[model samples]
Target chain A: MSAKMSAATYPLSGPAKVEINEVAPRDGLQIEPFIVPTEGKVAFVNALARCGFARIEATSFTSARAIPALADAEAVMHQVERVAGVGLTVLVPNLRGLERALSCRPDEVNLVMSSSETHNRANLRMTREQSQAQLLAMIAEAGKAGVPVNVSLSTVFGCPFEGDVSEAEVMRLAKAFADAGAAGITLCDTTGMAYPNQVAALCETFQRALPKTGLTIHLHNTRGMGLANAIAAWQTGVTRFDAAAGGLGGCPYAPGASGNVSTEELVHMFASMGVDTGVELGALLDVVAGVSDLVQRDVSSQLLRAGPRLRTHQPPAWMEEFFAKA
Target chain B: MSAKMSAATYPLSGPAKVEINEVAPRDGLQIEPFIVPTEGKVAFVNALARCGFARIEATSFTSARAIPALADAEAVMHQVERVAGVGLTVLVPNLRGLERALSCRPDEVNLVMSSSETHNRANLRMTREQSQAQLLAMIAEAGKAGVPVNVSLSTVFGCPFEGDVSEAEVMRLAKAFADAGAAGITLCDTTGMAYPNQVAALCETFQRALPKTGLTIHLHNTRGMGLANAIAAWQTGVTRFDAAAGGLGGCPYAPGASGNVSTEELVHMFASMGVDTGVELGALLDVVAGVSDLVQRDVSSQLLRAGPRLRTHQPPAWMEEFFAKA
Candidate 1:
């Protein structure tokens, strides 16, 4: 074994902290088969607010026909009780969505566009240039409303339609958004195609390029690399992450695949590593259980089934008897 | 962004390679509800052998009544085609198991013990000291038969019955085995209690202490940190890993949890990171499909469902029409 392989270079040392943005309400519920009632959505957001999350993306102000599951975006946004430290964010698709979201007085509005032209066109029915220009216009409008903007660049890692999205393309979009007065930028692995190396390399570049802007990683567990990618990014000092409770949100295009990295699992991993995410894991898990109930199915969360890492189990009856005899 | 977050410290740079040990036929099948026939086991092992694994743990030599799922261990081991590049390994529980496995002419024999006293007794029906003495004697026996011995220290990270196993305890056992001329030592996270920081710390120490002994990490996906821990260990230059096909095999103790990390998922993660595992992921995925069928259930493999990262999808019908209009 080489001495160079030692833990001297372990990125996290003492009392490190990361910000978790809960996106289950908007990202998770948007694609669900069952529509949670507006009250239920409001209740869920309130529950998450108490869990110490830095932000909770309450709902998306998209056209009702586009995502009927979260059609009650305004109701959820207006009804949710505000917490002092937790910022409430809502997705804004275009100028209309931004105007509606601004009327609700969201703390921050998230705008999204795809890095790959094909995915951009497929998802937004507009080309990359058109989406960027529209989002730039939305950023200016949201600025007038005194709300910060976070532009989520979908397929910054890879596109389902176009395959590998280049680093240059991702940098261009991220820089464009940062230049347009966006307070933060989220790199979305829309199809869970981002691996650890890709995540680390991109995060390093993004962080260096936009040191003043907050960087968030939005990953899916579609390929089982969500936590791996998140940890890799965290190792590179990228502190903000987007996770859905009970792993609820997934790409509509990737059939049969899991959703965003589970908030409980990501929190569990960071907490186990002694990195503070400010969220109480027990509280987060309780919310995850409610998520399972609200969604009417077992969600894709590992911590939901296998408790926390420190959870102990009793030995077999035979072993107990043998030990007693001994 | 700090300069410390740069890719200058990234672990893998060139054609880095790691060894993968397929343990599905043994560890994976042992915990399954369905029992595959002897020929099916042989065929599965043969298929895995062709996938370029460094080693294939084919079966365990224990009483048929103990784990009836793998009762045909002898038959499967004897019938598996001996691929030149792939070493066939079998689990040997005691002196009798060593003798039985020797008769089948296994390329290697893996002994078992638990670092925790409670897990040791619960798993092997003996004390840790007694198990170590017995394994040492068996190692001498295997040495005479010219078969190398690798001791798998279960719950090295944590024991379900005995919450946390100490690093000193793990180091003591690993050093004992290395000093006794064991070919390798596998640190088994019997339950997925391992976080990446713990994995990195332990792997670094184990690698430094036993430089000559091959270090293999056997991780479970119980808490969804399987790939994260694997990558963390890989970053520390501990190359050998043990994975099961279709992610079969769970701790009969940790109910409602996943089993070992899926072989295809691990291979895919490494392949995606540009790290060479020498296993053809497509071939491994095909075998995973077989394992899924043989188990008569959908196994806990993400790659099995999501396909590879680069698998492109055609845009929706409307998007295609929109593109055509453009």
Candidate 2:
């Protein structure tokens, strides 16, 4: 069969290149029980910076009392090696967090809220309206400082506390943020409840609603649908994604669920499909090795264990002998 | 924002229903370090039978010397409860295995061989030519006994030892078997080497080549592309899939690789997409739990850990109290 037939057979065509936004330092490290040392964190971010990622969410400027693991966010941001092409994005939860992040001159600032009121209150300790107002203000504040903002709207697919987050609600928030000067809007699958169809539908809607705004999909592999959702989103023309090294960072509320989609696995999938991720698989894997060592445990990355798809193995001795006889 | 736009946005459309073939008994148990008791194996098969799978590959009729884990295949087959609608398929390697499987009067007989010459020799201890002759003969013999045969073409995607088994070779072998009266063919990703584009391409090619023959895709999650490949195959209109409960069953040759595409996770994905899988997700999860208990360890099923997508959780106590104050 011709390659044309294969491409035609697939429903949605993907872009020539996808932009991977590395979120390990901020999202992955935020939920760890033990904090990674400031120096180790710096080294990790610096290693990721060299891997050709379009952006690395280096750290979150949230209160030290709230998230102790990223208490040294400022230190990590200041110390990490800044490559010319790779943008360093930092999470800013509020005006206070934005001020802290601004002092470091972040390349991009990420704001956070939730589509589900219950999840917003449970996660951010505020009502959805209150969180939206706060995030919108942060976006305007960051815009004044000439820093672009990407708002990560959590539970855009579904909420653990409340069953379904309506599509209209998600669209409303996304449009509101995009109109209010946010450069990007990331639809976050906070607890990994997003399915492939839901991802495609919402991605299609968000892309249509805010055609100029950069859209990113942040997914979790909690139900083993992370890569599937990623593929669906990509097919629907989403070019930006948020993934964590070693698949770190999970919601504490979703017991037994896995963390973010592994950066290596996602890049590997796109690369295997002949789609350019602009990230070197080998260099990215080497960085994951460091993440694993720093975590002091096996992280949930499949590629780390299985190797790449093209990695070859030696035939068993008996098989060789049998083949010789043949 | 309409549902029609969402459906239209998605590239290849999916069928309203899909068939799931449960392979935990034969594929999953065959590679386990410890053999489950015959009674336990019977109980496991019986549980899966109730979960609405179109077919259950109960056991292999291989020699006791070759696969000790499935040595009691006949005993288990005779004792297990056979639900009327569920077809019981047993793996038959050659004439001898086919004779043994025929005695049980199985609903279907599954024949297996590797597409790669080296994998064929290593796995079956015979050259590709020898395996083709043997399996074709078995298919003829099984047809004489009025038992349908499905040839499971191992390493159709890629071979761990040989690597990059040519698609032309896979197509040549599949066409050979289908021309020889095999009722069905299963493309096995022996090492989880199949990616989405490759799967869609091959599925489209195979369907066009043998439109009358039943086509099934068997996948492994070794590199975390299991569900993504499945979605691709479904989009290409190949409805039959082979999955294992708890994602049990892996290729011993691909060291450190995970097992088959998870049955529960696959079912959950299709169900979430508004496709009818016939199988009840809750019942399948229960069966997976039983499989885990029988194996005496955790199986790699994501749904078992995360629960179903709509399973709601109560907000944290502190959050609830805070909301109460609000």
Candidate 3:
């Protein structure tokens, strides 16, 4: 696309490149109405790995009854061809989920619980303390198994059923995750409540408080602020973010719609701003096409319709003639 | 919904409230396939005024042949109930459009031109200077007629037909507008080509250059960056933004689909971030619903379906029971 440059150009402020965690196979598809076959899921993930994605959240090991869409999570986890550097993450809600996830030998396990007292009970069917205690046990198991662990704390910004969340509580949860040996901590907006200022403020605080821990912000476009929040986070010194292929929300079945902040959109934004994503964007589009085929519907990608920003077209006849004369 | 507060309560690092100029009447309807009757257009403008939008770009006075959707612009302008505080702006291309628009007594006239030479030629059928010189003359005419004038410079960020735009070129155009007795200046993304950093950078530059001029960032979400760019501009101290009720683009004889940033979505984002937007979120939703009906399809709005971030639902039975036990 003519609208974007290959790179931002040498020099200038901002990180040299930002890392994107592709969560479409896991997060995007988890809530999809139809379950994509595990073979297709594996092929899809393997394709994403070749696109130079440093990390891919391949699947979630929740109950088959709870999330039948990801019922073959173990198969997808085992079948996706692991690349040399790409990290494969599977969402493990409880110890049982972690144990099932471990049997398939995932590169990393994502332990999730909401920060809100009410949401944790609703989503995980356990109190915050109970979930945390169990996650600590899972972390101990994961550490021994030589697999790193991360925690996704939902409602860190706001909750759907709850009105607002306190920054103090969020900080406490992040601190707990750091103390519990989480390889990284992800601040999940849960319902797209994040704004740029809040993102900047939280990232600033997290960097100061947990200097050793890597920080990731998972955002939803439910309110259409995903890319905006991502840019703010990136500008505020955050380097890792979770995004879906079509920006599909985690969906009603999973959490929310993984959201439609389509990964293509983020890649386009970073590339245009000269921020390196280390992704073959053209190849990724093919992957998106494959995804659209599997979903049997259009994915929430704007670039697919508009082409790249740099894309140009000949002016219409009247305009061309008028300009030609002038 | 309970997800949004009536107004932002606490002080924020950025401007407490941002000004939103509803552009659906002109920008949104222009691209629409069918020409709405004058009474519907009048009612639409009247309703937007009641929703607390201080400025509404009511209609464009382009030739009927050029843009049939707004052919009855004069009738709509004269028929709409005039709200005292609302500034109703009409887009006028040259002296002829300006003259016809003056007969209808618009509050403001917006003269638009593209910054890139190729786009300027294709879109306006004139050299950049020719368009600017004519706009200066129109400004003089509007000044004599006691109508304030503003200029909308398109492709200030990037052009689909051309490539990237020069900041120098954009600054020069702004300066010309300043010297032409224009009351305000709007930097339009045209085809959704703006990036947040570039938006922040350009607004900062323009502010330094034209301290007295009122600046507005008119963005399109074509690339899904409309809200992102708008937030960046607001944080950088550019308070005013132009948005459509349903993220409609400037379509010509289309039912409606422009991809401009949705006004309701922006209001929700600002409110959620504790930034006040004088517009009532609930009343604006009514407007979005109305627009969706007029377009005969769901408009490109997310919150219209998702409701506000503070919106709450009863906890699921399982979660309620789990929490009750605790």
Candidate 4:
């Protein structure tokens, strides 16, 4: 017998505190075709706020003409009742969008830019430097307004158009965000191009480079590795993550890219492993159901289909009879 | 500014060798309502054999009446042309099934029972003790017949009828299987009830008690933790795994339990991490397509749906023109 396996619980060893940021309202709904009405979006965010998520990306304040799905972001954000612990973060494109989002008085405003120049051009309709310059200004302006800033560096792992991205480039952008009065940074696997190894290596770099700044990972499950990569990231000491209600969200630009990692699934995995996410699984399930109703389509969540692991079934009649006789 | 992030590439770390045992022929088809033809089953097994799978569970020698889906197990076993590198194993329920499987001269015969008594009765229609005694006899008989025996302990993590199986109970069954001269013992998450922590714990116990014996994991993606759990198991130093092509298995007894971990997806994950599974992803994808044809339905494969992560899309017209203009 090998001595390495002497202990029973070694491999499942992971960090204790994992804060999940619900991004259903921002990344999740931004791409949905059927516009989730303002009231319904507000209700959903309010419901999620109660489900023990410490952070929620409420909605993106992009141009209404661009992402029509989240056109009512101001109304949705202003309408939702803020919970004491939940930090409502709204996505903004530039200075103009920041002004509109600040009016809603979200707890934080998140800025976006792509690590890939081509991706930045396609997603934000500007070059990477142009978006960065504008975002640096937004950060400075938001800082003046006393609103915390978060930067989501998209396509850090790989881009849909340009293929593999360099780690140095991602760090460069992350360093820029950290230096520009940004409170937090999110490394976005924009189209599920992240592998576990890449996630770990990147996270190690992030932790070493900017240990004091808050870090979050936003992953998509297009290639079915959202949770797996998230686990890898968590192992490297990343405590915050971006998850969608019922695995909502897909890239409107990147073809075949699917939903973000399911919030309930992440909560389920962490809870199962004895890690604390402070989520109420039963209440989270209700929010998932509500999201499903709001979308009127099947959500890409495995937990939604198969309930919690301990959910038992009554033994078959034959087995019951045989056991009863026994 | 850490040296780790200074490198352009990092993160894809894994064990050099990962053994993948394809189980679609047995576990994948056992629950199908429509019976795959005997010839198709043979060809599918033969096809999987060529796809760099070192092991394949060819069929189950259970009573034809008990599982009509695999009633042609004998015919399928006889027709598959034995390949040099592939070890074609067969599943057996009891001494009678072992006898039937031995007649076909399989490379290995896997004995079956459940960790939970009720699951054993429901699955094998016998008490755990009775099944263990019968399996011990089968092991002795198969040993004398110069055939190897592999025992699969089903529902070692959690049982549908009896939830939260104790680690001690699982270790007891694994120890029994090891003592009975079984060549390998597979820990079966028959109903997708096994979480990563439980997998890690049981695997540690198994390695401690039977370190030299062959160990394999049979995981289902029922709750979507299949891949996440697989990563956990890998971290614990267990490499051999049982995966179904196209994720083609389901538990008949455990209703709503979904398919096994998709073999191609596993291959993809390992390969992306620079680990060697010896299986060609493109060839495996074709095999997945063929299995989908045989089953006549869409199987739960993320790779089949989204393609590989590096599979680049032709940048959309707008993005291409934008970049061209830039």
Candidate 5:
């Protein structure tokens, strides 16, 4: 091996605390038709917390009629024992949802606004400008209530309804979110339509546009470009990323979309290349297996299926002998 | 967008020639049970030749009893017309096969040696050393007959029995092949167990060892790291690659060994990244579709399923009008 190959080790440097915001509880479970028991939800949250994730999206505070999946959000929240240093965040669509989230006493509140007008109207029955206004008010209210807030901009790439999204549009919306007292901005490719070039270009532009605010790119591997895009984003200097454990998460509204980028796969790729991702692969797989059993269906993650790359185990002598004899 | 965004342009470079050695007629059809008509094989070869492939593995000259799939090897040789400047190669496992390939007047002859003892013994009924000796003898014979020879070292990553193959062992075998007057060495990940790090490390080591010899990394996406490994190999300065159109080729003897790296997908990835991989995506997909129809199975090439990234179409006027109305 050359000196270069031996020197493959990335020191974890950016943040002492690697905040893995668990979206599976909200983003993953919300899409499944099977309503998991409140106990299951509580157990799942506890399990994620045990995996060293500091921030967990405990549940969404949306209307029961709107998202039936999160109907028992309040009850589930009440049952779970909160871990120290772990902040629970909940998605709040409007003032009513924000009020509900506040009642749960979440550490952080996430307010989302769709960049595309068509999606905003289809999703919330409100125009994009109206949704932004609602988000601004929610941010102001959350600030006064002493709750940290993060805003997720959905369909920042090409939207299903509007088709191609311009860089100018994404920047304008990102600027609006940053101005609304939001602690961070999460760029979401809701339909999994963003290409690697688009991702790199956008990340570079956003980093320059908002240098002080943390930028997290939440990717959907619906088109198998998630990891490629992630690499491109990383190349463009974006640090924070939102990845679902075992590749578990998708938009219910986006038809044919599969899963988010697998956390195991992501960490495996980075770690193999000597990049520090602050994730333990073996421990992560244990969590994936636990959740996969609860879900019943086979998960879409390949790393879970194939195990980590270059990972091997020595078989017992008898097993080796048997194969050798054959 | 700044100059940084300009770097995101697809096919990031001008048209650079990639040596596309079409393996369809040989490695592609050799594992099938059903007989693909001679006319069909000829047509496939003719189509692939026009698709800007610099090299084509036309057929194998092995015994019909061992591989019934390539029974029409001589017929394909006579029927298919080669493109000017496109080198045609054939696989020859033994001296008899070499004699048969020589009769076909192939531009180059490929001698394959499985690095795994168990596979070499089972497949060729010979030990690894014995197979290597036979391959060396065949190379000598081909040289005497004025035929250029390329050596493919299979099972270089891992073996079914050995589990893990060390870099030293792979290098030893690669050095032996180069010493035997082989034109180039193809380092194959026969089991699809190699990751990008391994690929980079191994390719760099091999290149350092044999600075004069051309190196080709043939990969399989059995575990979803094929493209990543290929990219890693390319970045490490190993330019030549072997990909099956629609990823059609694999060893029939190896279980769970999936398809080769898809030609369409590889071409698309390179083109999208602004790297010049001379093979045209549309033409390659056409070959993939032809092979898919001939084989009667859905091949697992993602590019063929999901059209190239940034694929666009004109919207209907009525739809636009309706959207304006809405």
Candidate 6:
């Protein structure tokens, strides 16, 4: 018998402490067609906040004409009560958006800058370098204003126009964010083009290049690898993650790109592995259901529909009994 | 900086030789509602044989009335062009099934015994011990007939009636199968109850107890852990896997448990990790489409819907014109 197989508990040679950032209210609601009512957004945020998520992306302060779904960002933010330990965050596109977000006084402001030049122009109407500099200036401004900044390095995974993104380019953007006093950096697989090998390699490189900055991963399951990429990032010691309730959010520009990583699914994956993410499974499901209701569409979360994998218990009937009995 | 983060490639510190057992002909077809023509089965098996699969579960020698899906097993086996290195296998239910399988002269025979006592009684009208003894007898008979035998421990993950299964009970069944001279043991998530943690724990236990015995995993994505469980098993040195092309096969008892782990998705997962499993991606997709035609339903495989995530080359129209002119 192999000596490694003799151990009772499979010891993974990696760090613990995984943190999931709920992006449903922001990323999820942004793409939905029918506007989720301000009250529904508040209820959704509050419900997810109770799930022990340390950070939740609450809303996006963008042009009302652009992302009409989240136009009532301030009203939603005002109505939702933040949990004690949870950080309520809102996305800010520029200094004006950041100023509007500061009025809501969210715990953190997420500033997004596309890594690809074409994506930057499409998403923000700025060059990649100009957007990076703008993001850095915003981070400096946020730091002075006592708001932690999480810079989302979008299109780092791949871009719609630019087929293959270089590792050096991603590292360069990550270093820029790190040097700008950004509280954390998130690599958004905006186009869902990352393979596991690429994710592992780039995450390792990013971690080494910016050791002090906290790294978060935002993945899309468009190609059915959201969970796999999350595992790869987890193996590389990335703690923070961006996921949507019921796997919401798809890129409008990227054809066939699907939803973000399902939050219920992510929680289920980590909690089953004996890693503590401090999220309640049942509560998270309630949030998924609420969000699904708010959006008026079938959310693409397998766990939400199929239920958790329990070794013993007949589901459907058993689930009704379990919940009723509870 | 963490030492693990600086390296380009972390050497996966366990077993590397991956064994993929193609069960498309048997497990893939057995659950289909439509009857696949005998020649179609033969052609499918021959195509899979050329894919360098180490073991191919070809047919199940059972009463046509019991499983009408595999009624033409004998004719399919008689027509398939046997490859030199691949092991052609069939499933045997009882002594009569074993007799029929031996007549076809398969390279190996697989006997399925459920760990759930209720499932054991439901699947085979005998008690757990009686089934074990009958399997032992079949193993003895197969050894005399000069054919190898493999055992699939079904419902090892969970049972509908029994809700949760214990690691100890599964290990006991594996020991019995190994002691009976079965060439290998397959852990089946019959009801999709095996999560990745349980998979890791059981695989580590199986590898330790049966060092020389082959270990294979047959998973259904009923609860969405199919891919995650595969990765967990891979990390624990489990190489052999069973997947259906286009994610076909489901249990009649477990309603909504329709998809198996898609062969194309598994191929993508392994290939992306730089693990070579000699199935050609393009050819596999073609076979999936062919089988989908034979079965008359779109089997759920995302990669079949979305092509491989290779880098796209999007040259500017002017650049393209310039190159075209040149």
CAPRI accuracy category, model 2: medium
Alpha-carbon interface RMSD for all candidates, in angstroms: 2.4, 2.2, 4.1, 2.3, 5.7, 4.2
TM-score of 4: 0.95
Which candidate gets the maximum DockQ versus the true structure?
2
Q: Can you list each candidate's DockQ?
A: 0.60, 0.61, 0.45, 0.58, 0.24, 0.33
| TM-scores, one per candidate | 0.95, 0.96, 0.93, 0.95, 0.82, 0.90
Tens digits of lDDT, candidate 2, A163-182:
88999999999989999999
Query: Which clashing pairs does model 1 show?
Result: none
Per-residue lDDT over A249-315 for candidate 6, one digit per residue giving the tens place of the 0 to 100 score: 8776565577888888888877767677889999888877766578987665667666776534343
Per-residue lDDT of candidate 4, residues B1-326 (tens digit): 01122122244333467789999989889887778888889889888888889899989988889888898888898889989988999988877787788889999998888999888888778889998899999999999999988899889888988898888888888888788799899998988887777786777778778887888999988877787778767766677899988888888888668889889888888777776788888988988877767987766566787888787767556766766677
| Error in Å for residue A50 of model 1 | 0.6
lDDT of 3 by residue, A113-144 (tens): 88998888777778889988888898898988
* B-chain TM-score of model 6: 0.91
- Candidate 3 is graded, for docking, as acceptable
lDDT of each prediction vs. the true structure?
0.86, 0.87, 0.80, 0.84, 0.74, 0.79
Overall local distance difference test of candidate 5: 0.74
Question: Over all chains combined, what TM-score does candidate 3 have?
Answer: 0.93
Candidate 4 per-residue lDDT over residues A1-326, each given as its tens digit: 11122132355555677788999988888887778888889889999999999899999988889999998987898789989989999999878899999999999999989999878877788888888899999999999999999999999989987889999999999998899889999999998888887888989888899987899999998776788898888777778999998989888887778888889888987887777787899999998977767987766567877888887888888766777787
Q: What DockQ does predicted model 4 obtain?
A: 0.58
CA RMSD for every model?
3.7, 3.0, 4.4, 4.1, 5.3, 5.6
Candidate 1 ranges with C-alpha deviation above 4 Å: A1-15, A254-257, B1-15, B254-257
Model 5, docking class: acceptable
- The TM-score obtained by model 5 is 0.82
Q: Is the docking of candidate 6 incorrect, acceptable, medium or high quality?
A: acceptable
